[model samples]
Target: MSVLPDPGASRAVLVGTSQYEHLEQLPAVSNNVQALADLLRGPLSLQLPDRHVTAVENPVAAHAVLGELRRAATEASDTLIVYFAGHGLVDAQDQLVLALPHTEFGRIETGLPYDWVRQVLLLDSRAERHVVILDCCYSGLALGRMSAGTGLADQAAVEGSFLLAAAAETRTALAPVGETYTAFTGALLEALRQGIPSGPALVDLGTLYRHLRLTMEARGHPVPQARDRNSAARVALGRNHANLPAWPVAAAAVADAPAGPDERPWPDPRAIRTVTGFLTALADVRVVSGLTQKAVSGRSAGSMTAGTVGRLLNRPDLPATWGTTAVYLSACGVPDEQITHWQAAWQRLRTQSAPAEAARPAATRDGGSGKPRVWQRPMSTFRRRRDH
Candidate 1:
């Protein structure tokens, strides 16, 4: 694990606007800001004191927001995070602006210019690391004016900065009715709280972004976007409460057991009652082996990519080819002797789903459509017959 910055040296500015002078009010904005603030101050390793956190609610003037940002820029020496939950608009020039309580639709000058916020937080801030999270429509436009020279390799040239937007430049950010936070912010909070599975003890920007993007997209919500220029991918955002070691030492001991079939007690494939049950067992084995989907893919010599492994694990129905299942089990360090048991289980499942002709009733075999009596044999019986 990489060393984390001093939590005490970090500062945060949370701005939320639920009441607008002209636009419709968003009741969830306040809840969004409060939930984020609580996370940062509570579980997040950023032991940011209440004094270091500047929270602005329904600021009528753009200067007030800028003033809080300027203070954070001057005060923070290690890390700074600025979060906004409200409305976002694009001016005629395609520049993004934050909508304050008094911001009008046509008057861009009245809104807080995202460029100014970026400049102050990324360029002018004394902090070593900077993070900007926007939960509003057109938030992706926040990166529209970033310096073209700001490439991932130019980490030294540009301070480590990460920008996360709730939606695309053209899409509207959604707030599910009656929910406390918008879809994006809610997902963000959930990811942060749950942490990445089989990842490091500390969650970073890259991991958080990936989780956010996948989760929101899966829920049919607007896709979020991230712009990272300061090698911010590795910077720790918070401690992962859900972090688990890749592999337990005891598991390696189990793997060292003799591979001989005579000495090994293979589990009965018939014990698996349902596809979901089999998948749950497979997932448990993977976790115990301490290998991530990416690591499992690499161990498989690239035959199975990380995405493929994820899909296989997520879906209750096994892959079409038993070869894929075998590859995954082997990669997860399942004993070769035990793998055959899994393969047998997989074959049984496939046979159960095979064409009706394979095991059609006597009446059906004779082409008599007499509502062919359904064969309701237990899996154990089938296993017994196959053994014979």
Candidate 2:
């Protein structure tokens, strides 16, 4: 019994600092912020508009940190989510402070106060729900009792607010030595992408919190803490992917296959049946390899220029020759064996279309009296180029 957020109305500001001046650098924090942003925008996940999500990473100044939060808070009318994954400091007054790239431990003033983040939402935001996720040391300090100067456990909490902290008041969050994301954010992403089994169709904050806590505890990681007020925990975060229908066997195999050691996800070429399909798959391989047009040209030793790569990807017709296609794939780091698969697919598609192409008319040179019967070289622009 939950609903997805209105994609146009919700706003999210993801902030994380991976580099530090006085404290140890957290390289995984940047990954956390980026991966979360991708999950929030991906069509398979939260389905939020790309523009509605903002990511601020490794800020050197507090202004940049507060500026994005203030903007997102002011704009959001449905749900406002502020996520911070970096160092959390407790000042002399025991207030939660978010560390920046240039933050110094002795000079806590250089960091942004968690209270300022709350005030921005409380005072400026018209959002119906406010969700704050903090993944840092002593982040739970932002949600404890407000006993004199024992640190305001979220002083003046918003009417409908949910604050999730990665660690308890005296604990430190952990970033595993070889992980891409910090422990807390990593688990959070997993829940969003993997979904909760035996859960409802839509995943609300309450379910997500349960999954996070249990999963982390089972893995011997820090168990997160949550302070939900006025049923803010009921707000749906995203659809439960686990409850979605399963993919077909063929599709599942392709989707689940791991990338090669080079991090290239060379697609299976057996599925391609048309010029468009073949080229589209080839373009996808280039994208997966993280190769730019210029990079491809350079990698291919200038056999394929950047301009040629750009045009080739956009063009619907097949390349002028097999050599062109092979060069492009080789530039994208496709193995010779895989390149052979692509070559076979390319030939099959061309041959399949050849009969229809052979009957097509050409320019009126002999008053169109004769069709490809007069001249035949596959009767395609791709073939015409080579003939000329």
Candidate 3:
């Protein structure tokens, strides 16, 4: 038997935004998030390691949640999981839109696009297992659509990383009867709790999709459908490497503090200089990495330039809320493992930084490292490897 390595490197970010004071607000969104947390931290907890879980509530810390998730992907972890419970919309072109906490007046200006999230997930180079379970309206966008536009029921298997959206783009994902669980989340919980038994089944992508549909229908709810469940059409971890300098340590000696109410605090003035210095280092890394052959190829026929990706990493402009990052990263294609890596790094740095001078006010910048950092790699000499 081929023994798979321990998934200790794996990490999950659960973003559940339930309260929306706006007209687009859906109360069940929060319920779905809480239920998902219970599922992961409860019965599914046994399947995952103890240290691999981080659950964020409401919209306050969504961006921080996403930054952490991005960091996790960069850590070269083997598995990354992201679960989101909220309202999902689509653009005029039928693309997906993940709504945030303060999304208001049905305006597209306040939403996060699906394409952004996809970019985030594609950042991880070492993840062998990636799963995104999004229980939102028209979430099928999370799973790339079939280019052929063939309506025939198709299936995809999960090898390294895969996504499971709550509903297909054409369908409206529904909420469950009790405990604010969405139909998709409810079915997923059932499958995780009783679906995966002590058996020899591989629990491949097809099986998981089938299980999800069967379990949902069995419970008398709308049947769950999956897009790009076929192994032929999944996300591939690319083989791009950069010769960038080592990551700088002690940026403002920043420390990651617990997510609490009114937690607005500033970094140490001393650490600010360090953060500025690291930002300079990151800028150089991006320039050199960009000069190299930075190419990204995925299972889907789409490819992105390393320079474009480097911009996503370095650009720090964000909404002034917690869940915005999670929503944005989910939209960006940033993987969950990478986010966890950053969270770990943030925590470590936070420990070395000064204490909270005041409540962390709502700001686009987290007052730490403003630049997105990445390793440098060339696009040349990047051949698809059948085995690592």
Which model scores highest in lDDT? 2
The residue pairs that clash in candidate 1, if any, are 246-290
Which candidate would rank higher by TM-score, 2 or 3?
A: 2
Cα RMSD (angstroms) for every candidate in the order listed? 20.5, 15.9, 22.4
- The whole-model lDDT of each prediction reads 0.68, 0.72, 0.45
User: What does candidate 1's lDDT look like per residue over 1-388, in tens digits?
Assistant: 2334444466899999888777767788899888888877654444456777888999878889989989988887767888988877767766777888888877988788777887787666888778878776543232211111112122112346777776542433376667778778888888777777766656778878887788777887666677777587766666564774435334344456566543211223444533544664566456546667777877787789989889888874555678888888887777776788888877776676577546766545544565533465677776675586
In angstroms, the error of model 1 at 177 is 1.9
Residue 115 of model 3 has an lDDT of: 55
Residue-by-residue lDDT tens digits, candidate 2, 53-79: 999999878889788888888887778
- TM-score for each of the candidates: 0.57, 0.59, 0.48
The window of 10 residues in a row where model 1 has the poorest summed lDDT is: 143-152
Q: How close to the true structure is residue 81 of candidate 2, measured as C-alpha lDDT?
A: 87
TM-score of structure candidate 2: 0.59
